[model samples]
Target: MATKNVLIVLSSHDLLGSTGRPTGWYLPEFAHPYYVLAPHVKLTIASPKGGHAPLDPGSVEAFKADPESVEFVQTKSALWENTEKLSTFLGRAKEFDAIFYPGGHGPMYDLATDPDSIALIREFWEAGKIVSTVCHGAAALTHATLSDGSYLVADTPVTGFANAEEDAIDFSQYMPFMLETELNKISGGKYEKAAEDWASHVVVAKEDRLLTGQNPGSARDLAVVILEKLNA
Candidate 1:
């Protein structure tokens, strides 16, 4: 079988809302997935403006004990240092077999409403390609709609950083909008979450090829699912 091409979109927004704290893509959310899929697929990393996608320092500190996350920072792989521009692939969704978003609070600020990102996602869904996200990465799906103008998640089983999870982290007030609230508003009862906060929860609407993970803990699991879908 031919190799699959996956586009990993990271956030360019680095500010953590009005708190004046720093935030970007979460370290493990991207690192764990990259390692799981890299050897088997072709991956391209991109950001809104191309170059130096920021990392959420808090995540780095929190997951510092994690070897993969540490290696990603200590080694400074070419992936995050020099990401291609997200807009550069706007009209080329067909060139990829899938698109993945690994989250941080930053995406809630930018990727959630980025026009180029939304268009690219729509193109992928319309092309019947896999659309995947983990944690707040699901923010990228908040504004995407179908060709008929209905929400893409309106009838799909989806999961994201839940309100409970957001509250547990105490970063809810610093958010532009609650990730769970927005996802629930548009999901039309299709949004799901684990019984408790921070638990691993992943949902895959196989028929639609829409896959989502509840939080950072679900990152590796989500990537494994992406691989399953890619190789199915």
Candidate 2:
């Protein structure tokens, strides 16, 4: 059987915390999905501007010290290379069956506003493909629209990086607006969260073709749902 192609969306920002403390993409968000999906699918990583996507140092540090994390890291070596540019991926996204976005502050700054991302999402969903986003990565969803000219997430029971999670890390002030509030305001959807931190994740919506994760920790579960929906 031909391997199914999965597009992995990553953040382009390489900054630390809002305090310039050096933050990058959450490592677990990348590792969990990569490991979970590798055995059954071919994966390609993408970023808005392409090149090297940054990893949150804090996330990377934890991955370095933990044995289980390190084991997963060694198993998924494809992530260490530079990802494809978002523009290029968007142009050809239809060839894939699944598209996923990992969480990190970088997405809030770029994907949330990138026209290419919005178009890619619109195309993916309209084509009946499985779409997934975790943590702040759901910021990309804020820009997606439906075939009826409505926000794709409007009225969808989805979750992402929440206000409480931001507050816990003291990064709320740096965010232009909380993701949950912004998603609710734009789509008028009933947003939900598992708990205070990004560690707690949930897959709130799983209709025909959409799968969204609340935070980093949810990435593994999110991939499972995506693979199931695709194979089903």
For all predicted structures, in order, the TM-scores are 0.97, 0.89
Which candidate gets the maximum lDDT versus the true structure?
A: 1
Q: Score candidate 1 by lDDT.
A: 0.92
User: What's the C-alpha lDDT at position 193 in model 1?
Assistant: 95
> Each prediction's Cα lDDT score?
0.92, 0.78
For candidate 1, write residues 89-118 as lDDT tens digits: 988999999999999998999999999999
Error (Å) of candidate 2 at residue 226 is 1.4
lDDT of 2 by residue, 37-132 (tens): 888998888887777777777886767875656775566445645777878865575799988888888788878888888888988877778888
Clashes of 2: 5
- In angstroms, the error of model 2 at 101 is 0.1
Compared with the true structure, model 1 gives a TM-score of 0.97
Estimate the Cα RMSD of every predicted model relative to the unseen true structure: 1.0, 2.3
Runs in model 1 lying further than 4 Å from the true structure:
206-208
